[model samples]
Target: MSAESLERRTRNYLNNNVPQIQDHGGHFEVEDVDEETGEVTVAIGGACSGCGIAPMTMNAIKHRLPDEVSDISKVTVRQANGPRAAVMPNKTDEMEAMEEYQDYNPPF
Candidate 1:
């Protein structure tokens, strides 16, 4: 299949099967496709940055994409976020403290 058609179908598959990703402010981009090797790379971005479940989402993509898209035999997914000046941008101090102490249990 042509690269354009492959990409289009892949996008459609993700949109149809994984609407939750978009619902949660995440998005997937088809970064590249190697027709000969049948490998595709996808970048997951937006609210997926620093998300605890992003790995699970990536795993799902790696397993599902090839099955759903023709000419795709392998999948590679990466977080699209580059280096940030501050970790967890827009996170309030309260949020940070909550995350830091989420597993803590006082002896009481």
Candidate 2:
């Protein structure tokens, strides 16, 4: 598939299967697609900066993205705010509530 098509497909997959990303004010950006190797790089940003579930989100992208998006053999996720953001000093009630669903695995 063309790079544009691949990116579009990836975005659609994220929207449909990983709605939490958008629901939480986060977003995924298709940074690059290696047509020759079937590899994709994505960046997760916005509220995801200090999200407690950011690691899970990245893991899902790495393991599940390929299964949903055609022509994608591997996925690399980049955190926009760097690794430090993964650990925040405080957690709000909403964030704590989200922890209850940490094991959530979206239906394919």
Question: What lDDT would each prediction earn against the true structure?
Answer: 0.74, 0.78
| Model 1, residue pairs in steric clash | none
List the RMSD of every prediction in angstroms.
8.8, 4.9
Q: Candidate 1: lDDT of 105?
A: 31
- Inter-residue clash pairs, candidate 2: none
Q: Give all TM-scores, in the order shown.
A: 0.73, 0.75
Per-residue lDDT of 11-105 in model 2, one digit per residue for the tens? 88887888888888887788898887889999988778777667667877899988877799999998786544555534443554787665566
At residue 21, give the lDDT of candidate 1.
Answer: 79
Q: Quote the lDDT for 35 in model 1.
A: 73
Which window of 10 residues has the lowest lDDT sum in candidate 2?
Answer: 87-96
For residue 107, model 1's alpha carbon misses the true position, in angstroms, by 38
